[model samples]
Target: MRFNDVIMALLVIVIILMIIIPVPLGWLDFFLALNISLALTILVLSMFVKETLEFSVFPSILLITTLFRLALNISTTRYILSDGKAGEVIDAFGNFVVGGNAIVGFIIFLIIVLIQFLVITKGSERVSEVAARFTLDAMPGKQMAIDADLNSGLITENDAKERRKKIQREADFYGAMDGASKFVKGDAIAGIIITVINILAGFMLGAFTMGYTLSQSIQKFTLLTVGDGLVSQIPALMISVATGIIVTRAASESNLGTDVLSQLFAQSKVLYIVGGVLMLIGIATPLPNLPFITIGIAIMLSALRLTQDKKELEEQAEFESEQEEERDNNDIRKPENIIPLLQVDPIELEFGYGIIPLADPNQGGDLFDRLVMIRRQIALEMGIVVPMIRLRDNIQLDSSEYLIKIKGNDIARGTIVFDHYLAMSPGVVEGEIEGIDTIEPAFGLPAKWIRSEDREKAELLGYTVVDPSSVISTHLTEVIKKHSHELINREDVKQLIENIKESNSALVEELMPNLMSLGDIQKVLSNLLKEFVSVRDLVTILETLADYARSTRDVNILTEYVRQRLSRQLSRTYFPFGKAKVVTLEQSLENMLMEAIEQNENGTFLSIDPMTSQNIVASLAQEVRKLIQMGEQAIVVTAPIVRFYFKRMTEQSIPELVVLSYNEIESDIDIQSAGMVSI
Candidate 1:
């Protein structure tokens, strides 16, 4: 063990040994002085520390000090009754400090005990109890605040962890302080009982056995008993006061003295009022004039000085403010100052004045909160973080029109009527309800705007009903999903790699920079998202890339391999039912497309004739329209190699069409060929 640890262990043992061992009067005096000094140090240290957690070990200190004081009391009591003397420290306090009057010394000791037990210790216990309870009660809120700050990028992960630790320490410190105050209370009661025992025992031994007169015995024993009590009670009183100070102190950036002075003298007006009150009393009352009048004049002079200082401080502040404004004006004129303006948000939803209430939280508009939830929802569904969205009002648009933009380019626009609900038929409606004719902004389905009164009736008539805010929110969600591929950047892909690296480091290290770059990884993820595939299963995606990246660094081919590797997810997502209806390509057509695949420096491309491609597109559309008329999604299943090229060729004409490979579909789903594409 270290030397300091040895000393601490020996100190506690010695304190316990003191209660059982006899010591010389000189040693007793030294120990008594040490006790006083320790108590004083503790008191001062408590005042100097700005926060309570800085003295988290105070409860243990309180227990140790109380034990030391009790042991000292026992030693002095033994010496006083057995030898008629304890030590010079106690004797001096009895005679010099209390004027050798037993009655006066005893009264002083009792007063000290009463003050500590009744006022300081009692109040400290109550405050500690309440503080501990409140600290624990507020723990959840503090933790949530830290998490929110981390999510909002206001603080880093390390900062959040540190704050959470501090909160837990606060709860623990207050809990210990609550229990430690009991030691002070019990010590007060013990002090009283020990004093009584010493006096009574010393009197009996002196008068009966020590061969002293009754008056002498009473006087000698009384003085010695009062002195011992005084020495112990003084230290106990200081400790109790320290306990109260620590429990009541608020968190601050400065020591107690500085805080007290700054807060007490914060306002010159309050000081001036007090000075006037004192001056009036000194002049009007018949009480002592010189003392009160002298103090009153001093206070008034201090107040005058304080007021003059305030004026000078205000003038300095105003001058500094003007200088700062001048510097700001110059800074604005600098060309580099406009650099921050060049950066644009990844996504922005700019609405008109009529849509303000739908977006303003203060006006019961939940659009801001809806946006937050939308980010989380997309993260869960797409396995990619939706960047921070910017919401604002644009006056250039129609009053009800709102626009959604990606990378500063407008993508979609919609209109809303506040306080009105959009009603659409589910094709099972019993009857038609009278309403304003409209189209659903999200899916472009036929819809109607109905009054608040008609919302319930429209729903009863089997029509789907939604509010204006929901309409805008749904439209925005669809637009983001369609354009999420545009938002994936090198940084975002790096974050995903880092996230997956935490668990699958070997896979990430194998693929990144060695075989593929950040840009390559981002491109592969974008291609997956462009097809509405969830990258949430990033581990599987990365592992597959690591296996195939060595053969070819082409992102398009890598994405194709990743899609096949995520066959289960594809099956579960696209074919939730046990059956599927899909359009299939003819074997001859598949072979022709696979043979037409060509490689270049840019990547792979389909080299088929334009006329044949157009004829194939027309033929595929004609076949896929049969499923569309049957209320089925347009799906085309082909060989894995031909799926990519065919999807690219037909994407322009049918952007919503889902082109799948036979390898992408799970075996459990029985596929019925609804039609076939031929050229």
Candidate 2:
């Protein structure tokens, strides 16, 4: 049998023997039977109504009620038998232990209950410890934001540091709150209730008079009536119950419900005056039982209601939070037309201090001191400072040859090309990447064919770490070059480049394998701008790449609309070309177009309709004047007789100027896109 079943069976057997053996053996048998019957009824009732035995204030109701009646019967019977002319009683063991044995058994029961109390209280402590750890871990990101803003000249640095310190203080505060929570947890409150009830019953029995006296009892029984002592105990009783209720309500997270419960159930100084009045009633009146029962029951019921209220409130709040999350998910917008950008790759860091004997994963203080010099060197290079060190767990070191085999077979053999640079971009910070040429021979290790562990070793050797993004552009460039053959036109390639230049990598991560679609690209950008705080350099890169990509494809009409809507952005500002150049490229192209338009008509021009010729000439002249003023590098016009192009003269020793179209006016067909512009 399980331990609980064994204990329970022993208790049942004890009660049964006490009731049965005394029945045929003595005059006090009825009283002994009453106590046994009460215990047996409780045990049996607990099987069906398991909650009555639960370690909560409600469970104390059943225990205290049953024990109170047991005390009353035992006291009454013992006094009658001992004071009267009855022979001594014999127990089931045939020992003449007298009428006092029943009281002895009750004392043993109290001891067993205390042991159970400790077990439940310890369990509460453990649960609260886990809760405190979770709250501490989740607060870091918020702390970092405040710190960054303060450091970037937007806010005072001291304020940011103070904010971080406040978060730590809050974590500690919650841990203390957990301790307070233990006082009101089920087991502690239940134990307190049982103790208070026993005190009340003891006071009444000792002070009240029912004309009862023990017959040949081991100790004399008092006929004391309920008196001033009941009054004195009332204050202490109120204090204990009020403490339990208030602490329980405060520790719970249900905001409004907890507040209401706390206000209603928690006692005020006014309640203490009322309690004092009840004490005086006990001092003057013989019938003190009603007041005790009323007060005790009131406190117990209040505790139960507060517990239930907290639970219900939490359930409602949890449901609301879940619904809010669902709505957020549904409202997520997918962009109809956008672009894709660069790809990101994860980089690993290798620590040089191979399996050190004294490393403590949870407490990195000693390790930080040991590695502080190197860390500071890297930090100086990177231009960053970290007040605390965070050490990762589960680092492994292997034999040199094993490292060589893994690096050679698994890493270098893979599809990634790495370049190594010592101390690359300065000191290492979290999320930084350093390039490595080959995975082999860093620490008796080589870049080629390195295993994962060996690659980690190389990181420890000379490599610095960088953000996953710092290398994304390089990776995308490689991908484009490899897949350029698949592109249908130069515009496609240009669009791809633009998208890469403008996209935010962290947002692109959401699109995953479907990043090729415009909708996915737009969704990523929207999600990124909405979700992330303090946009990093990576976010800037993604946005740039996206804009560039859209320009190349010209698929999203929104870009064109934006281009036209923002006149300043589209206005060409470059004027007379340069020092090494005779004229500005824009002026040269404009001059060329102008010369071509006039020259194409020949030195003398005529038209069958003189008015049509004048209109054509005038329109051409206005277009030329605007082209020069606007500073455009190129412009095309469709006309009746011929097409003209002003080609900028570059090869001839002639000044950088425009040339007329001696070439034919080709078929008037629409060319959809500008190929590529190299800057």
TM-score of each: 0.61, 0.24
Q: Indicate which candidate wins on TM-score.
A: 1
Q: Per the 3 Å backbone cut-off, how many clashing residue pairs does candidate 2 have?
A: 67
Candidate 1 residue pairs in backbone clash: none
| Winning candidate number (lDDT) | 1
- Tens digit of per-residue lDDT, candidate 1, span 31-149: 99999999999999999999999999999999999999999998998899899998899989989999988888889889998999999999999999999998887676466545544
Q: Which lDDT values do the candidates have, in the order given?
A: 0.88, 0.35
Candidate 1 residue runs with Cα over 4 Å from true position: 1-3, 140-164, 327-555, 558-679
CA lDDT, candidate 2, residue 339: 29
Model 2 lDDT per residue over 640-666, tens place: 222211121121222222221212112
